[model samples]
Target: MISINNLSYYIGDRPLYDDASLFIGPKDRIGLIGLNGTGKSTLLKMITGEDQPTAGEINMSNDTTIGFLNQDLLSYLTDDSILHVAMQAFAETMKIQKQIDEVLHEMETNYRDELVDKLAKLQERFETNDGYTMQAKAEEILEGIGFSTQDLQRPLKEFSGGWRMRVMLAKLLLEKPSLLMLDEPTNHLDLPSIQWLENYLQSYDGACIIVSHDRRFLNASINKIVEVSAYQLNMYAGNYDFYLEEKELRNEIQQNAFENQQQKIRQAERFVERFKAKASKAKQAQSRAKMLDKMERIEAVADEAAAVDFKFKFKVKSGRHVVKMENISKSYGDLNILSHANAHIERGDKIAFIGANGKGKSTALRIVAETESFQGTLQKGHNVTTAFYAQHQLEALNIQNEILEELKQAGSGKTDQELRGVLGCFLFTDDEVFKKIKVLSGGEKSRVALAKTLITESNFLMLDEPTNHLDMMSVSILVQALQQFEGTFLLVSHDRDFISKVANKIWWIEDHEIKEYPGTYEEWEWWYNREQEKKKSSPQPQNSEKKEKAKVAVEKPRHDDTQKQLEKEIAQLEGKIEALESEVTKLETELSKPEVFGDAAKMEKTTNRYQSKKAELETLNATWEQLVEKIG
Candidate 1:
């Protein structure tokens, strides 16, 4: 649909892209992967023509349509309600509809021939475009991105920046152009909403180029990976996992080739050195020298590894019960945030606290961290040490201190060398570490907060939106470090992909109630779907004697043949239910155990099977109930 030819772009003195060319075809779903400040978003802007490249051109067919969702541009349109803003994607259809209405009115009043002709043409256009279904399409796109039906009517100005971006996403999806470009589309979405988006994008027919740090989303949604590295663009014809393996293989091959070339050059040089004055072999040595001179030297690509090695050194172990809360009720006037909530975190539990925005996730984190209080029994486990990193922890940095000093004060017990290494891992290397905290950008400050958090030797870590300002590479590094850490983690994150990778248990807070599901995020989703299906299929309880109305009247009871038959059927169903239940239980038990849940594929398969069995058991139980009632 679009072709980028010899595209080179720069920012000031930095070259973002060099001779980068890519072709986006129909049905091509691509994940644009890169490190922080590698110009992923800038490249998208150039592709969409919102930003011009420093050199080269982007060619597109005249009829091709493109929709680009820019995070920064969402604040421009604030007067309209969220629904009205999103519905603007159908403005052309709406205009055509209005024109058709005017023509019909004119024809009805005066029976003008021209009006009738125009009306017929307009009707044809509307039908051809499926203009009648525009509103439904818009609603579907909006709802899929987690916008509540009621939220559509609210003014866009009332919503926070995150929600405004969702409104933008809805509009972009509703437009359904030939090419769809999304930058961090899942940034504000909850787990359910992210899943919904994944399913939607998986089935999206048009071409899409998404710049997102959500690894699981990329692995599940994209068919290709486009990596921007070292002022060049590299294409891998598969998803993120495929890209990883392919990139590694390619690097290994290149390394081996480079090694072989270097060895050949060395041998040739040695021959030339040893036979410089030899009479018989002089010509051969000279030939070898010439060959060595002409040979093109191959250099191995630089090894890219996360600079920081995060190793948690705990000074004190947490008590058996890490944290305890009871009868917790928090409210803002009449709006109850949480009520009668009780929770306990053990010594070695990795808990993911999740919910939609403003559902008391942060509030709960604050309460547990003792930064805030509610009317409840909140107890810290004996010898419990806590290091809490709030979403806005970066704002608390000392402006006077440089990045290095700020990290030093965090007192992670690391030597100067180790502290510098940690700072380098966060991209604050060399003179960057000497920059004052106040001079740093928001993302840099966030990195500083992360570094400072790592310095604390607390057994229990409570991190709120730690990945918010991080780039894809930084986020991956953090995820890896957290996965390897031995300390307990209670994280509040909207990043579904991150949660899926790190969290063993999900504590879902919804509608002032919290439910704990012992599995990965995908498993939680499967279980939720099965529960919804059960609700939809379950029958309402019947009143007493309801079964008697359907029973056939019998003389002398006939040795209770109907009852015996029903009993036999019930027994058979019970047996099936027992077997299914056992399978589900076994899977759940395995998933609940920490060791088994670490294997991503195994965990997913086990969880999927568990969900299927649970659904089957529900069906069998319903059938058994029906049979028992019929027999009665």
Candidate 2:
């Protein structure tokens, strides 16, 4: 629906995109990806006509409607409820409805031809667009994004900045434009809200382009990745994971080709140098020299993986217990953020804290880190040390100083050389380290903050939105480092795949409640789905059928004999399965302990027996659940 030809844009002397041509077709779901300052958002602005390209032309179909959600702007209005602002997208339809009402009133008063004709046209248009269901559809979109029905009646000014953004998102979805553009849509969403958005985008018929740092969200919502690098746009098919693999494979191929060409050039130059002054071999020398001149030098492709390397080294050992929170309750005036929350953290535990934007995830983290005061018993284990990286902590940096100076200040005991080396790992190379921190972009500041955090010797790390501005490669490096680290972590992140890969347990906060689920994200999702289906299919009493049977002359059996027998069998099987699973968990935990590996033969025998039993129990449980679901 939109096309760009030979597009080129620049900020001052720095070129953002040059000779970049792209075509966005109908139903295209694209994930825009690039390094920091690579113009991903700038490109979006150009596409939406908010900014014009330095050169080249953009052609969009005249009939197509495009809706863009501005990441930096929030709707401001007086005396307008959140629902009223969101419903403004359908203002034309509402106007038509009002006109129809007036026409109907006029028709009742007088049999006028003009009013009758106008009413017919208005009714036809309304029915064509399914206007009668507009309010219901709008409500569904709002609720899916986590806005309560009661909150809809509250004024827009009552909602916070994040909630207002959700209101804008709901309005965009309700409009159902031909093309949709979203920048970091998951930034303000909780796990459930993100899941709802995934489902909505997956089923949406129009084209969409989203720029998000969340790998899991991109994988779930987008089918194609459009990467902006080296002042050009590169397209890749499939999701973010596929893009990563494909980009690496392509880089390897390019590196090999460049190496081969360089080898040939070196050989030619060697021959030329060897025979330069020989009279007999003068012609051969000159011929080789000319060949070298004609040879097309292959410029070495950039090492895509060298952007950043996060390697955390811990010098302090954590105690057996990392932290403990008892009866923690936080409130602001009349609103309670958290209520009677209790949690315990242990060494080497990678726990993810998940919740909505205002659901006290960050507040809990602050209380644990001792950065904020709370009314509760917050205990830190002996020998426990923490490195806290808050989202807005970078603002505390002295922007007037150079990046290297900022790092040196934050690094404490680290020497200048040590700090420079750390900065290099985060992509500050050569004289780039001397650049002023004030001139750095958002992503650069984030990287600098992270680099400083790495220099610390804390045994426990509290990272909030650490991957917010990081590219895919940077995120991978951080994830790898975290996976290899021995320290405990309490992370608040919206990246589902990152959490799935790193976290062993989830500390989910919802509805003023905190619960821990021991599993990967995929397993948690499976369990949640099972619970939802159970709730939806809970058995209801058949009162009408029971009444009819009560009036019968002959009395039937109290219950179905076959059903009772099946229920007894299923219960026994389930009990056995539950015991087997508990045993399996215990065995797995034991196997993971260092002491158990001292006896290799015994460990192997125990694992083998456990696996056999686990497989049998899994099959039996599956069969039992299938039978139960069928009968229930």
Write out the backbone clash pairs for model 1. Answer: 412-455
Tens-digit lDDT track of model 2 for 357-398:
678888888888898888879889988988999768789778
TM-score of each: 0.79, 0.79
Q: lDDT (CA) for every model shown?
A: 0.80, 0.80
lDDT of 1 at 268: 86
Return the clash pairs for model 2, or none. none
Q: Per-residue lDDT of 55-137 in model 1, one digit per residue for the tens?
A: 98899888888888877866675778888888889888788999988887777769977777888899889977767656655
How much is the lDDT of residue 575 in candidate 2?
A: 64
Provide the lDDT at 632 for model 2. 56
